[model samples]
Target: MAKDYQGEEILVVRRSLFDELGEFQGINADVDAYLPSLLNPENNFFMDRGAAEDDPSHKQLIPYCIFRVKDDQGTRYLHYTRGKSGGESRLHAQVSIGIGGHINPVDQREDHLGFDTYMAGVEREIDEELNIEGGHTNKIVALLNDDSNTVGQVHLGVVHMIDLENDDVAANEDAIANLAFTTLEELRGELYDRLETWTRCCVDVIEEL
Candidate 1:
């Protein structure tokens, strides 16, 4: 079943054993294992038709993206949150990439016009998270989709560095605790250990950029 995400909650899903094992073998194996399942025509995961009537698990998966911004001084800033998820209470701020949530049925129809459905979701997510008005000016470096790591398929929309200094962008308090720009070294040394898969993917994408 699709999980409900209240404005107050943050969901972090993990990769499957197949994903973890494939990481050591090669990227292709990992990609093949996860991607085909999602893109297969026989599978209802990517189809827009009303297969929900036949298969109860036919609900569309939520699509999301991650953004990595850098400043003139070469300091990279990632969006993050810090708080208690359950019984654990630690005053730690998790540094992660910036992006936003799923493409709702309404968003799929109205917000994204010319782009691919998934690309549209990425564009919408960036706009919603950063309060930006249009597609990112930076070049899209990579498009990654990994379902093994999440309950819903995760699409990593990697873009070239963005200059957030002049922009009026700020984190939504209800969704995050604090958002700041930190160095890559800091992210790897201090924050990576505590990060979720989505956050780890952001770091990986940024390193390639």
Candidate 2:
């Protein structure tokens, strides 16, 4: 069964206020600088998607990452499949370079401060989707948004780039499958139509040759 988290509260901020931070219209971002402003828990808080869904003004913050693998064969990126029973219906069969979800109320505990604490959900999502055999490094790169569309209207994507020390990452659940590693060109051409909106818009983050 698809994970129905409709009523569960998730963190978000008004787009007008989020926009005050600066231009986050598409993919232009500097994580170190942009992130600090968003860390203010007061500016953001939890609200059920059931109520926020139709309200594009309320942009649900989502932590997203693109896992990269570099080996003797060169560089490759991970793209996973969304099983039919996946929580997100619009993403089924849509190959995506990004992996992540929303922040919950429990995740906002006052004690857990700083970067690691803020990215706790991002770490959790990465571990749940890919099994890493070696040490991995990740960094926030850009902020992605597309308020033009419905999904884009309701969600804001904080994009990160993660590079693995080794090439031993694989799918950890049925919800994620087709663990394929492909070059930027390969992905851009082959998975062109299949790429999700966020991935398609933020491809450059993972398109490194």
Candidate 3:
């Protein structure tokens, strides 16, 4: 059975605006080229999630954060398996490198939606999912899109690469299981086939990011 998401509002921008800015298949590392206009108060707003879920006219803005750290060996990224309890049922059981969620009305500031408001939601979403004992800096590295599937059709991803001071992180939700940090080579090797579509997209061009 499908979960009832009535009354839930998520941040979204018109698909027309996305096309106007320039749309691509996978990851586009040109963030500065589109973020300003995309997050402008006049360009985006909150909408009923149930209605937005299937509507291709709107694209939900998701902050997909990738946590990474450089240790003795090499660079490693935080990864996990999506448990059934996750909100996106289609991605359950798949391995994911990113950690984030939907932006809601709570992220809005006094009826205004901008980069600050968008980032507030990003921080909140990450906090709700994980516990980080170390410091980190978040940088918006790219924008992700995938029109080949139902889930991807209605959602857009803003990829953030978070550079962690250390690998002291733990999952706070059951949705994130088997949490661990691994090298890029490992992710591209044995784990490549098990990765979710978005993660696979990010992995394919992560070096540039």
Candidate 4:
């Protein structure tokens, strides 16, 4: 059964704001240009997820994090498959490199909403999904958008690159399956075809970097 989002309130920005900030089809690396205004409290609000999911006028802000570790051979990235128990029914069973989800009311601070709240939600989502045994550095490297499919129409992604000192990571939830670290070549090769649309876009962004 599909999970109900009626009672949930997630953070979102107006689609008009996105267009006004200069919209693009895929991943945009220019975070500085768009993030400030998009994350501004005046430009965002918490809406009922049931309505937001079907409403393209609002884009749900999702922090899509990609974990990485540098080894003797080269840098490897963390990847996994979304299991049946995942929240987004449309993305279940799809391969992905991102580790994140919707920013909700719980992320807010005393009726306040901003980047700090968003980051708090990001950290909460990551901890709920994975167990990392080492220190890491996180950077917001890009923003993802895809309007070609039903799943992408009302969502916006903030891509994060989390560099770990060690690749000691494990899945903490049933939603994350076959969690493992893989090389860029492996991901760009055979696994490319299996990646979710947003993950595919992230792979392209990584390749260009």
On residues 1-209, what C-alpha lDDT tens digit does candidate 4 reach at each position?
54586699999999999999998999899999999998889999999998888899999999999999998858999999999998888898889999999998888865378888988899999899989998988899999999999899999999999999898899999999999999989999999999999999988869553
Best prediction by TM-score? 3
- Model 4 reaches what TM-score against the true structure? 0.96
lDDT of 3 by residue, 135-184 (tens): 99999999999999999999999999999999999999999999999999
Across residues 1-209, which tens digit of lDDT does each residue of candidate 1 receive?
43233332211112342244242311121333543343333332223222221232333333434444444657566556753441112223554454554434343433232235445655565655556433444444433444453322423222334544443456543455566667778777777887655456656656554
Candidate 2, after superposition: displacement of residue 136 in Å?
Answer: 0.6
lDDT of each: 0.43, 0.76, 0.94, 0.91
Error in Å for residue 128 of model 3: 0.5
Instruction: Give the candidates in order of lDDT, highest first.
Output: 3, 4, 2, 1
- TM-scores, each model vs. reference: 0.53, 0.88, 0.97, 0.96
- Which model, 2 or 3, shows the larger TM-score? 3
Q: Tell me the alpha-carbon RMSD of every candidate.
A: 7.9, 2.6, 1.0, 1.5
Ranking by TM-score: 3, 4, 2, 1
lDDT, candidate 1, at 182? 70
Candidate 1 structure, TM-score to reference: 0.53
TM-score of 3: 0.97
Clashing pairs in 3: none
For candidate 3, what is the lDDT?
0.94
